[model samples]
Target: MPDLLTDRLLLRPWRESDLEPWAAMNADPEVRAQLGELLTREQSDAVVAGMRADFDARGFGWWALQVRATGEFVGRAGLDVVGADLPYTGVDVGWRLRRSAWGNGYATEAALACLAFAFDELALEEVVASTTVRNVRSQAVMRRIGMTRDPADDFEDPSVPEGPLRACVLYRKQAR
Candidate 1:
């Protein structure tokens, strides 16, 4: 995928040097809380490898989110086809930023760009995003990006731990 530029972010592929900070973010409890599990450095490397391979093979996946002005790695935002049993399948929009990058509209900005990529570049008909019932912040971002809830499409995420089926809220926006 081509490197995407926003006002403050540079969306590009992952680099070998990004592992340390990425692992740190993955190890952070608060960050991991939303993601369901904390990853060790080895696990983080495996993830980076998977992401790199996905991009090479599919031409698109999660791109590393970096600060354009400072050249700092903040987090990642991009398109993904989450392989979980649910009502819908195919490309989905998602993002995850460092705690310091939160509340700065970076998520919304980067995500809107990704949506544009999906609808325009990828020629997708629609994109979907879902979060745990308790993840209000993500849900709010979904609404901010003009995605609407589809209650009938909601279901338990099989990839998540087997406990209480956390109500997964599915939100989607159609391509124009």
Candidate 2:
């Protein structure tokens, strides 16, 4: 997939150099609060590898987010196919930003771009997003992107172990 350029962010494929910062971001407790347990170095490396493979094979996946002017890797935002066991089965938009990048509106900006890519470039009928019921920050991003939430669509994420992160809320937007 072609790299997406927003006024302040660049969404592109993962790079070898991103591993260190990516691992650091994954290990941050504050950042991992909503996502899951902190990831070890090997686990973080594996995720980067998987993202690269997915992007190569599918032409779209979690693209790395960077500040265009400073060329700093802020985080990642893009779409993924939800696992079949989940209540929702479709492409889902998601994002992860470094703790330092939080409250900067970067997630909302990049997410809106990915939503357009899903509907316009891929021609997907709809895209969904989910966050732990307690992840208000992510829920805010979903709302900022114009996704609607229905409590009835929410579910306990089957993949997440029974914990604070298991119960999730689903939000979705259909192609306009």
Candidate 3:
């Protein structure tokens, strides 16, 4: 698939060349602290490969986010269906970026694009986003994009190991 461009960024499938930078960002302790576990280089490679395959198979997954002007690979943001076994199985929005990309509204921009795709192109019924209890930044983006908190929807991530951030705040927005 080709890249999905926003005004300032290019969201595309992962390429072999993206492995190093992706691994570095995923290895960052601060970034990994929020995103669950730090990925080893090999693990990162597998992740990139899996994302590529998933995109090919499903027509949508997290797209590698790149700065359009500089061509710098920032990170990724896109729509994913939470595991089928989970309560929420519809499109779910997500993002992760390098430390340098933080505080610049890229996450929100990329996420908005994904939501547009989900609601407009995919004709999805709804999109949900969740963040660790402590990840206020992510929670803020969810709110800024019009997702409303559904406290009843919040649940311990059956995926994350038991820990301080195991519980998550769930937010949802229905397609108009």
Candidate 4:
């Protein structure tokens, strides 16, 4: 897959050096606050492996986010197929930035790039983003990217145990 460039960020393929920071980010309590439990080093590396495989197979997957000026690894952003058996199914735009990377609008920037690639390059009809009902930060990014939400589209995430995180709200943006 080609690297996506924004005004200040470079969304490119994963690298071996990224594993260390990636694992550290996954272990941060605040960073994983809405993402469930922390991941071990092995689990984190496995996640990177899965993302790489997805990119090789589909030519589109989460890209390792980096700051262009300083070449700092920030996080990841891309499109992923919403799993089967979920209340809904389709491609979804997602972004996860390190705790230090927050408050800079990086998530919104990366998500907008993913949305453009989905609608313009991939020609996907629609893309959805779902998050825990309490995750207003991500929901804000969804809105900033022009996704609209319908209360009727909300559902309880079957994978998550019954709790606040189980209730998820979905937002969608159709190709224009």
Model 4 residue pairs with clashes: none
Candidate 1 regions off by >4 Å? none
- Backbone clashes in model 3, listed as residue pairs: none
For every model shown, what is its TM-score relative to the native structure? 0.95, 0.98, 0.96, 0.98
Q: What lDDT score belongs to each candidate, Candidate 1 first?
A: 0.88, 0.93, 0.88, 0.95
lDDT of 3 by residue, 1-176 (tens): 65677899899878777889999998999888877778999999998888888888889998999999999998989987788666666778999999999999999999999988888888998999988889999999999998999788888877777897788888999998
TM-score quality measure for candidate 4: 0.98
lDDT value, residue 21 of candidate 3:
94
Off by over 4 Å in 3: none
lDDT of 2 by residue, 1-176 (tens): 68999999999988888999999999999999888889999999999899888888988999999999899999999999898899779999999999999998999999999999999999999999999999998999899999999999999988899898999999999999
- Best-fitting candidate, measured by lDDT? 4
Question: What root-mean-square deviation over C-alphas does model 1 reach?
Answer: 1.3
lDDT of 2 at 34: 85
Which has the higher lDDT value, candidate number 2 or candidate number 3? 2
* TM-score-superior candidate, 1 or 4: 4
